[model samples]
Target: MIQLQSSAMQDTQLVSNMMYFYSNSARSSNGRQSWILLLPDLITQSRQQTRVAVLATSMLLLAIQSREERIFVESLGYYCQALISIRRQLPLVTDPQNPDFLPLTCVAIVLSFFEALCGTLFNGYYQHVQGAVVLLQIQGPRNCALVPYHSLFYAVRNHAICASLMTGKISPLAGEPWLTIPFSLSKKSSSDLVNDILLAMPRYLSALNADETASETSRMSREDIVQDLMNHLQNLAGIWSQISQHEHPIAESTQPTIPQSVELTQRYTYDNPYHAKVIANYRTAHLLAFSLLSIILPCHDWDVAPFLDDSASILSAAGYLEECDIGCAYFQMVFPLRLVAQHSPCATRRRVAIDMLKRWCGEKPVRGLANSALEAIYRGQCVIPQSPVYRNVYPDMSTEHSKACCERPVPKPFSYTAKGQWIKLDGMDTYITGDTKAQRAVLWVYDIFGFSSQILRGADILAHSSKEPILVIIPDWFRGSTAELSWVPPVTEEQQQKLGTFIQTKASAAIVVPHVRTFAKCVKAVYPRIQRLGIFGFCWGGKLVSLACQGDALFDVAAQTSPARVDPEEAKHVTVPMALLVSGDEDAGLVARYAENIRAETHVEMFPSQIHGWMSARGDLNRLVVWNEYQRGYQVIVQFFDKYL
Candidate 1:
């Protein structure tokens, strides 16, 4: 210590901390260090990009430990440098035969880990994993049996599966080749087996989800999906039963002292952390299978009540694993613990699971991201209460009834090269057009069919207004989870239910309005020239726009076209000038009631001939009438914003 250089000391501490945290995790030991623990060796021997990624990962770990903004900044700097270097070198490593292929793969995995730990955008983590998945596919699974390649594949596979879960897409690794090939040379571990089963969940869930909205010609029969899911359910249930038969005697001497706030249940403690993990995983999978069954069939025969009993057991095992000598084992339990907290029927058990998560988050920096994601899901699930118009006037309208009542036109593909380009605003991909230097701006929130050709054209028109050219921005509010065209016409009963669910969950006003405000604030801050901001929405977005315009809103003025869930009572609190272009399909009485309550310079025009989504997602602009109406709608908005903003 007498001659210790501060920089050297810091680097040493960073590596030491990373090793301590990762190596201590209950991982499948293959007579070698885990890929994460190989960082120190990788730093010395790897290429510049791989070396930079390892350094970035270590710096981020230190940043997490110290909670220092400067260290975090340093980590980000290294991360971007690594990313640029990797992209430049990627083409050279396209051949798996190249010596740099393994290093390139390693770089991608490291970058993915960094994003997962602390990415600002939701898609950052798994999006990087997707890139790595492509690379792994190019390399082929058979080559992954090699020493360093095996370790990298073993590490990236979990993230690949997690990415699939996050995106609702089937993982490439879900194929039989991937599942069997890597382990062809060696036996699969307990965790590997558990992961193999877990991998099927996303594929099956994705199939079922797609089938619900698919046309009869394309859709799988519900019976076939159910039968396949039932097979997996049986397998998981069998695994759970077999694991339950084994007795794991707890060695109190080896058990670390768990904090008093977190109490472990008396459901068989284990000396082996791997055993505890296996039990927890299988139980979680079994519970998930049951949940899937209920969603698939929703009949009393597939009730999840019987599986509800396992919630307590799952948490008990998770708690035990978290308190074990290998403290980082809890990282593996993040998904299972979250599932328990989310789906567990027992209130007290859910509380315990949440409490444990909170404690873990406080102690470990990585838990923050996992917890944040879980919290976002919780927020998304909260359905904003619908207005009386939707609740009483004409509730539970079938898809056919809705289309008929609204004069909904079948959406057709139209080719229009957008005049404006896409750029990120507030970490969201946004469509920006018109005068970038304008002092006034309009924030356009599109209908449920996100970023449709019609919506983009509308934004371009608003931006390029002949007399009043101003900036028009349309943020990708849905992040690609837009309502499918199939769901709109909803030929099948399942599609109808899916549409309702999408409205209640994905496009919920509670979830979107806050983001709208944030984006508005960001726009203002980023463009200091923007002295005033106006917001407008169509269909689903109209409801959010309406909500965003109330109570000392960020927007100077607001406009809505065929707003869903129109509320007269909430309109009474409007603090800005508002305009409504009511569609023929909408309840005129409700619009009048809302307009009457608005305490602002308000304009209400009735588009009696047009459908609900005419100016945005549903309009057939090729037709003369639809084209005329669409142009007029944009003109009205430009005129309104010109007056107010």
Candidate 2:
């Protein structure tokens, strides 16, 4: 692995310089864009350089190399970055343009080379794979006028590739003795495993840097390279230590350095890197959703979901086989996977085993796994109705139907927002990520509501605004709210009046509530730096749109879809310039009475064919009604957001 990395690095400069030349000139000449004409020439060049990288990487692994190999890696890294940049500049094509082929071909080869080097250099660290995925993912959205869903999808795509590699699904090289290592799991925690892997790297690097054929070779000035690499390893080791410490607080940190060995056996002793990532992502998503008062899940086939292979019996059969810690604990709690562990006499082993089970199967926050957890470690306290959050808003909430299916209690504290081309006034953080492609986004989105989200935070109009920060409004008391699960009969005329008053009180509290109300609360604290606001919502959130409209007239414009129960009288209070998007069900007699007034009052679009929670339904197949509606609605929603706030 080390040898291959060394070899890949050998060609970085040469390849990067060539790519830069191609890119520097490719622009300003669409007439001359020719994949057929120039592609073969580039391939031939790649064929030779790739061979050098392969051999050099092999030599580096075997502990033999010329100083030349060391310089090669940096060069390769540079070129990969360049090719990534060029590919990003070209317009993404759906109809297969000629120029598209050229850039695509280059990106493929360039990324392959980059992956080879980074993969080998880092000893196949999953983070590098993830970074490589992100690097490739940023291309399309760079050309589009909206936020890049491609980046998100691309990340998942590469995740699949990496998963395959980790699982021994596909080999990087054919019929080669190399690429055989790092194919199994590591028994040591990832942090410990990293140190162990790096211990063997120096030897392969030494060979690659040394001139095996030069009998009298005495290499000098390579001190910096060696030190730089050691630094990299040390930094990685540090991160490993930190993550490990989270779960293993009681475990003593040892000074034992990872053994430096070229013949070490790869440990498939039960730790898959993807499992960790899936767990980490699950944890991150949980926090993100919890903070934003939303729910998120990885959109994929269950077969590919991390850790659990059988999918069924994940909860029942999964338990700890090893010692556990906070990191593992947090991971288990966050992802909806089954836990696997075993009872152990060994302390570390027992801890690990227990930790894994508790996390994946625990009930409190495992909202998604509630009913699904008959085989789980724990069970839900209660099962609520899968009704829309509009019961209080309508006399007959049955009019609007969204088949969300799960009746798990909603976590308390709710909020919503969308920032269309938001304006950033001054004094905000500047983050330059991926290709620096976002540089074209001079239009800052300061909208507190909507975000140009690829993650699909909102169940309504789907779009990404470059100007907006992800605006999320959280309702107070998210976990089992006063209104979260009311399995009551329809509101009576008298009850409707009473609840209308209740709605008024809630509305007044919301209207008057200060300090961390909408996502704008965060923005306001962070702003003067932030300017402009975009408001949006789905289901009951539509009501929030109305409330925000009444109070914040400065919100240039707002869009609401499938709103919750609205005070019929409050319709007269809406003052903000806005766009009202609602499903057919939301437009009723009284709600309908305000429709004309709403259209006259602001921008309004009614989707008569759609259900209220159409945006969030993850229906299996049946594209015409479910998928197409979401897609078309997403399109129009994006378009509407594109035109205004």
Candidate 3:
């Protein structure tokens, strides 16, 4: 009997060690503390059965730690025994109304963790997650107020939210009762606020997907839903701001606090590491919230500047976390950091975020989550919620520009008030704006939807915004073929083939280059005072700008927005200073690859929320979001010209 007691104590100690290893070392720690706290109760209730489960869990941890085939098999045997025992007790323990339901759920959660570690072919972990969700729904919030129950409830809720996002499925927990649960005022912390925001994410995603499928008549109501979500986000941001001002109240007052600093070295030796971790967590929440807001709000309504600012804060916080040797805290930040990496216009910040992700991957195997982060960085695309009206106007492009010029929205015509007169140049009608007597000149190239009022308005804004006196000229580059054409939905293969044929024959580089040169010479002849020259192109015109830069020295500088057919071979010959502004949805990998080959000083700026042709094709001029991006792109062009011309 004494020997039996000694053996039982040894097994319990082993169980304790395994619990510590998993809780402290695993990539995910949800519900781990709660399980640890319930260990004694579990042993007391069913010592033999609980010992088998604990032994299985310990062996699973050892298998992961050792990566040995023999140990993994041994762990599987112990797991099978525990699972059988649990199945026998399921009738009583799985009943949500029973007092033991929460404890049993915790046991199931831990077993699921072991199953995931064991490399189960089927998604065994998700089964456990779904089971927990059903139990929580049956138990309700009132029943979740007990010792281990509250923590388990939060852990399960959080896991469901994250799993739903990762799997691209609407969360089952995203129901009215779950979202409407009022926050406990006394228990409020930054973490709790973050949880509240995260719980709302699935509803937001559902609304966005719903808006995509809504009928035209109901689109306006859907827009209101998006607006309501935005207001909620704004309120959350306000609460976060208030919370960040104070040190985390839950942190012990006796612990020394380190002043927030950006220096990596100083962070490494900080007296109070938890204080820095709290700040990092707050920043992570802000980054994710703003990133989601940027997606949900219309491009014309969202502000990219503040998003950029928040991204910087996240990067700084991540660096602080890394240097403080609290990289586990930094691991929780990968998703938001990856969002910033894929969408931020700033190259340096994006690179830093990517590097951080790579570093994390190198540090530990994180079940391919890190790999997905790298993939998102390279792809540089995310779904943005849009109204059905907008969807009807601009459908998804089927192929790259090689097949056809990518489908773009037909911008509503605006009044072109810029002072300019049409002049015949190289057998084409040209509209000139700005000072005709100015020594410098800018040639504007139109896209497939040639010489629209929207393009003219953009030209007028450019002409007026430039600091120097210059003549702005718009050439009818499409030769009137595209004047009456607009994007019709259900774009077919035959239509794309015909469009590609037309581009190859009528608007190819062989045909457009000489005409552009003739027009340039004609402009110089008409205005002898013109010495410095620049070319600005949109869409199809962007290709012309590239051709002109490569084939001739007629222009000192060139700028293009949403350029098509910019092959890397052609980019190599670019000899003039060039500025390229592209949409976030464009192939960033292709652009970055081609930019490297360009011989001249090249600046490529990507607008995170803008679609192709956004600079000149947004139908709504009054939208702050669209107008802001338009103004920002225009200023970039103007600055590039002012510096080079």
Candidate 4:
């Protein structure tokens, strides 16, 4: 029995060495050194059972990143046994006066890391974070020493804040006694200052979330708290900027360093990965602060230009970090990067953010946080029922019903004329109307109905009304799958299912946005005379127009009539002038909120007498009131283009 115990102890020591080496080398060298160096002492001083638990947890983490599947499964089994043992000892560890309390606290942190590495659900990580919080509270600030515990405190604090932001739940750690822990700024690095700002974010967000439920007096107080936090973050950012500037002068930093040959597997050998991480973290802090401020302030009241500029800076830093193999060094960056992806409104920047998440997932697949971040991106891109047009059209319907409406076809009342030629552009059949020689162009993105006579006629009306000769190009963004106009609504369960499937597969913003971008580029290249371009879409197409207006300057003006799937979050990125024409029967409040959120000049016209799909429905053309509204709405579009384009 003594010899067996000795052999097991030898194995544990070997595993500890391997885990520490991996943590320092594979994860991060500089940032993780303190934690890695203290692990041995932490393990030695721990109770026998607690020591076994910590070692098992550490080995489990290493096994997760290991290339061997059998090793991973065996480690998981051992960790499970350790967890059972730890659970039985929880009562003793929970006591603040117990000798094993701090050791157990450190072990809980390692367990939280296990949860993080496995990419357990958001709640899973939060539970472990709460466990750590309890331990830290028991340890208290007076007993908390700065060296070994500092890194753990910061790590737990950051995890709590990030999980809170991602899940929209206030972290338990963000509250009173925890926040009172002194984070000394004097000896702190720039990264620490940025973390301080991040640690305060959950409190700010929690206040903002609570303001809606609070009484007027309480609301004002919460708003004041939010504003103060914002100011504090701004000051921290300023201090970080000064420190970084002094530490990394422009001349010295800008001078190109000689590129060293690095193997793909040995990329982490580079020296400046930490420097790049610091820079990225600093920029991300500013991005988060500005983003929160934008959320708190009214859309028209705040200038998004700073947010835009900061997003660009973060993207640049992310690129450098990627090259340095430190892209996934900080999990805290995932939340900020997710925000950038969701809110930037610039398609290029959003794509970069998404790609960064993808790259991070590739690099750190064991850390399932990137997968959650990707899901957030997917959610942002997917059409939801909260859109103004969607809510108005299907006020009582579920998200599935709103999606069904996009696939339901509108009638084609008129005939395709010779003036409007069907030509193939970029290997896709396109319906072209208006003057081909015009200096100005309007890309009329049609809804799920594809190219119909009614839509082409509307294009002709727009071209005729333009102050300058305008070439209206209608690209079949839907390829050829367009629903035929029907006098009766399709009510069959099978039909509804088909429509829903079609919307999910074909009519998604993800699928349509990229095609629209490609089609816009093709149209511009086809007609070099088109110096100014405007984009207009109806219903499903309106969502595409909104996306087109997001970041690319290809379109000078954008107009959406009865636009569906215009995510309010994505809508805030619009910088170009916009015109929103809606039927009076639609959700006026939703539209008004959307109009208010747009940053550029916006004109919202409501034809209260008209119904949804009046602009594109040939059946609606017969109704005098609907026809008049369509004419008026078209006139609004022409005037908007004339003014802006």
Q: What is the per-residue lDDT of model 1 for residues 1-645, given as tens digits with 9 covering 90 to 100?
A: 123268657656666676776666636435545776666666667787787787787788777766777888999998888888987887666788887777677677777767656765556677678778888888899988777788778777877765665445678898889999888889876567767877877766655556466666345666876787688777766666656654353434545333344444434555456667677777766776667666665444544344555675677676676666353454456666666665555545555777777766666644544655355334322111111211222321221113332225457768889999889888888889999889989898888788889988888888888366589998888886887887656555466557666766777778888988988899998999998899998877877887888789678899998777677777898879889998788777777888889888989888888887889878988889879988888888888888888
Candidate 2 segments exceeding 4 Å error: 1-518, 527-529, 598-601, 617-622
- Report the Cα lDDT for candidate 4: 0.62
Ranking by TM-score: 1, 4, 3, 2
- Work out the TM-score per prediction: 0.56, 0.26, 0.50, 0.55
Give a tens-digit lDDT track for model 3, residues 623-644: 7887788878888887888788
Q: Name the lDDT value of residue 241 in candidate 3.
A: 74
> What is the lDDT for 606 in model 3?
90
Which has the better TM-score: candidate 1, or candidate 3? 1
Superior candidate under lDDT, 2 versus 4:
4
Superposed model 3: Cα runs more than 4 Å off? 1-18, 21-35, 40-73, 76-94, 97-100, 111-127, 168-176, 179-186, 211-220, 245-302, 315-331, 351-362, 368-645
**TM-score, model 3 to reference:** 0.50
How many angstroms is residue 347 displaced in model 1 relative to the true structure, after the best TM-score fit? 2.4
Candidate 2 has its poorest 10 consecutive residues by lDDT at 258-267
Model 4, position 567: C-alpha lDDT score:
58
